[model samples]
Target: MAVIPVAIAGAPYEVRIKAGILAQAGRHCRPFVRKNRVAVVTDEHVAAKWRATVEASLAGEGIASQWLVLPAGEATKSWAHLAQTVDFLLGQEVERKDNVIALGGGVIGDLTGFAASMVKRGCGFIQMPTTLLAQVDSSVGGKTAINTPMGKNLVGAFHQPSLVLADPLALDTLPLRDTRAGYAEVVKYGLIDDAEFFEWCEANGEKLLAGDAQAREYAIARSVAAKARIVAQDEKETTGVRALLNLGHTFGHALEAETGFSDRLLHGEGVALGMVLAARFSARQGLMHGQDAERVVRHIGAVGLPASLRALGLDCDGRRLADHMLHDKKMDAGTLPFLLMRGIGQTFLAKDVDLGEVAAFLDEELAA
Candidate 1:
């Protein structure tokens, strides 16, 4: 078991990673859960797989679990489901002092955490992220949100989980395509500032995707530690230090909006292509070497992620895609800050980006 500490000053917590941790969920979550009855929020797909095991574990600890299993997908992260989840928790008589469990992937964690944040002013929640994307990225950072018609993650709050239990055994049930998509975030840490880790990924990413237990644990622990250090420094993203974490997200979110935030392009798939675009765009502006940009594209393509915007076959023009970014949460003073790379490990936020120029670049990418 690898325990990574998220050192947020007032709400420090631990992300415990291990194989079969979900089977021992009750034992691990005993301290944070206060009452005999606990409310667990999950999705229909996840409930069918691990729900019984989790229920049995909690029962062994003399706790009764009330469950709210929602329909699965990005669409579930909406105002409608938020109200539903909040109502369910209220129906269960959850208190601000009590902890509820978020027992699925990113969708469950985001929705449940946001619901917990609003119930009775605020309440604590536990994160049992069952996906690689959630385990490595979304589950660790205290950024809980739901997608709005305007954009992804536009309406939400910073509600930290009391504890995060990531079980590698969960991935054994995940589809290979979903696992590969989640692996994109794992590669993001390397692209953010850890070139050596990027090299490690170049060598071991295939093995990690192939279900190597040691590799999965190491990658999750390392990614969590990196995020913990950043979150501790800039909890609210007021400082630019935390912005590094959004290296591929700005562009990725735009792509998601373009695709209507549907299964046509998974969040991680959008991010994978976004990182490629960021790199290639960096190279186009001479901020990074062309060879370095191609390297990023090579790794992303090798991993079977979408590395080319042209291949998406979108009928919209570049201007329309850039328009989607106008609704981005990071838009400030009529300018959107872009994450561009100087190299694999060198990402910086550039605020002087012109959307027209970005449209032109996208046009070029779309044409290429």
Candidate 2:
């Protein structure tokens, strides 16, 4: 198992990556578990596939657990589900000192973590992310939240997990569409600053999707390490260093909002398309050569991800879509900082972005 440490100030955690690590979850989690019992919050899809292994592992360590399995989907990330999760934890008699295991994809992790942060004022939680997307991105960072009518993750807290067990074998059972969505985040790390890694991704992305264990592990480890370093520096994103992590999120979130956060466009899919838009917009702003944008679009497209907004076929124009970003969480003093690129592996946050120009630019993109 490879352990990547996230050394955020006053709250450090470890993200463990390996194949078949699920069976040894008890042994791996023994140190941080404060009580002999834990409450596991998961979605039905994940519970069906991974609950037995997780429960057996805990039982092997003589640890007892209670589980709350929710419906599977982005809809699960809401006030109703949040209330359900918190109430379930309370009913399980979980204490502030006991750990609550978030044993599913991003939805479960976000809802459970946010609940743990709110329960008894604050409680301990463990992240056992099952999907590639969760394992690579959402599982490590302390950011936790459920979507509100206002926006995606507009209401979340920074509650880091005590331990994260990411068993890569989980991806073996994921649907191809879901795996491809997760790959978008994987590519983001490369586009953010690791050009060579992006090159590696261009070479291995298909293999990773085809169940290449070695390739998958390498990508996950590299992405996790990159995020860990950033989170350590700016845990709360106060320094904009961590903002680099939002490479494609601004436009991506707008796509998500336009889609009503539905399955019509997955988060990673929107991000895949959003990164392409960012790259092209960078070229338009004279921050980089148009070839760089084309390269990004080509690499992401080669992986079967949607690299253009036109692929989504929304009945809206770019200006309407751009209006959605007005609700972005990154907006401060009415100035939203956009993450743009100078070249592959060279991304920077730009606050001088004019939303009107962005709308006009999108009008051109949608028309294209």
Candidate 3:
């Protein structure tokens, strides 16, 4: 087991990673779960796999779990489901002091955490992130949100989980495609500021994707520790320090919006492609070497992630895609800050980016 601490001043918590943490969830959650019965929010797909395991674990600790299983997918992260989840929790009589469990991938964690944030002015929640993407990134950051018609994660709040229990064994049940999508986030930490870790990923990412337990454990621990350090420093993203975490996200979110936030483009897939574009765009702007940009594209492509925008076969023009970014939540003062790379491990936010130039570059990329 690896215990990484997220020291967010007033709301410090621990992200516990292990091979079978889900099976031992009750033992770990005993301190935070005050009631004899707790409410668990999950999606239909996840419930089919791990619901019984979680229920049994909680039962062993003399706790009864009342579940609200929702339909799975990006669409579930909406105002409709948010109201449903909040209503379910209210019916369960959840109190602000009580902790509810968010069991599933990013969708469940984001929705449940957002629901918990609003219930009774704010309640607590536990994160049991089953997907590798959630375990490494979304589960720890407290950036709970739901996708809106305007954009992804446009409506939400910063509601930290009381504890995060990440079980590596959960990946054993996930589809290889989903696992690969999750791996994109693992690679992000390396691309963010850890060139050495990026090298480590270059050597071990295949093994990690192949279900090497040790590699999964190490990568999750390292990524969580990196995020914890950043979150502790800039909990609200007021400082540019925390904004560095959005390295591939600005571009990635735009891609998601253009794809209609559907399965046609998974969040990590968009991010993988977005990182490639950021790198290539950085090179185009004379901010990074062409060779360095190609290195990013190579790793992403080698991992079976989407590394090319043209391959997506989108019918829209570059201007239309850039228009989607206008609705991005990160937009401020009528300007969108772009995350561009000077090199791998050297990402910086560039606020002077011209959308028209980005459209031109996208046109070139679309043509290339």
Candidate 4:
């Protein structure tokens, strides 16, 4: 087991990553858990596979743990679902010192983190990330939220966890589509920083996807390291350095909102397609070489991730897509601050961009 330190001012925690760490969750979580009760927030899908082991581990620590399992999907990240989780935790007689454990993917993490932020005004919480996407990206960042009608992750807070336990062994049971989908975020770490890592991914991505344990650990640690550095510089994303983390997320969120934030276009899939679009748009603006964009597309495409919006087969036009961008949280004064790249490992936010030009580009891309 490896514990990587995430040192954010006023929000320092560690992200522990290893295979088969699930069986020792309580031992791994001993430091943060002080109160007697622990709420293990999970989904029905993950509970069936690992709940017994997790429960036993907590029982061994003499800490009583109750499981709160919601249905599996992005829809679970909503007010209705969150209210239910809070009710369940309150019924479990939770206290401020007692902790809520996020024991599944990003949805569970976000909802549970939000609940922890509210229950008794605040409570201790731990993250047990099971998916590749959760391990490397969402679970590490302090960004946690539930979805609202206004937009995805609109109702969230930067509620930092006491500790994050990521068991890579859990990824073995994830469906292949979800596995490949996660690769998109892993690729983002490379795109935003560490051009060497991006090139390494292009070369060894197949090995990483082939279920190599070492490869998985390296990806998680390196991605966390990069994010930790960025967060150290700017925790709340107030500084533009952290905004670079949204490399493909602006267009990606638009795609997600257009799909009603459903599983039709998974977050990572939209991000994959969004990264492709950002790269191509960078080339169109003379910020990057066209071949560099193609290289990004080809690498993501080879992994079976969605590298183009066209592949989603949605019945939408460019004007509508550009309209979706208007709702993105990053928009300010009607200008969408897009993360454009000069090349791999060289992304900067572009404000003062013309949405009319964006609409025209989308129209042309949609027609093609």
Q: What value of lDDT does candidate 4 attain over all alpha carbons?
A: 0.86
For each candidate, what TM-score against the reference? 0.99, 0.98, 0.99, 0.97
Of 1 and 4, the candidate ranking higher by lDDT = 1
Model 1 stretches with alpha carbons more than 4 Å out: none
Give the Cα error of residue 299 in candidate 4, in Å.
0.3
The Cα local distance difference test for each model comes to: 0.92, 0.91, 0.93, 0.86
lDDT tens string, model 1, 1-368?
A: 89998898889999999999999998998888788889999999899999999999999998899999999999999999999999999999999999999999899999999999999999999999999999999998799999998999999999999999999899999999889989999999999889998998999999999999999999999988988998899998887788888877877888899889999999999889989999999999999999999999999999889999999999988898899989887887788888899998898889888889889999999999
In terms of TM-score, how similar is model 2 to the real structure?
0.98
Best first by lDDT, ranked? 3, 1, 2, 4
Query: Clashing pairs in model 1?
Result: none
The RMSD of every model to the true structure, in order and in angstroms, is: 0.7, 0.9, 0.7, 1.2
Question: Which run of 10 residues does model 1 get worst, by summed lDDT?
Answer: 242-251
Q: Count the clashes in each prediction.
A: 0, 0, 0, 0
Runs with alpha carbons beyond 4 Å of true place in candidate 2 = none
Count of clashing pairs, candidate 1: 0
**Per-residue lDDT of model 4, residues 107-204, tens digit only:** 99999988988899988789888888898888877888988777888888888888988888898889988888788899998998678999989988
Candidate of highest lDDT: 3
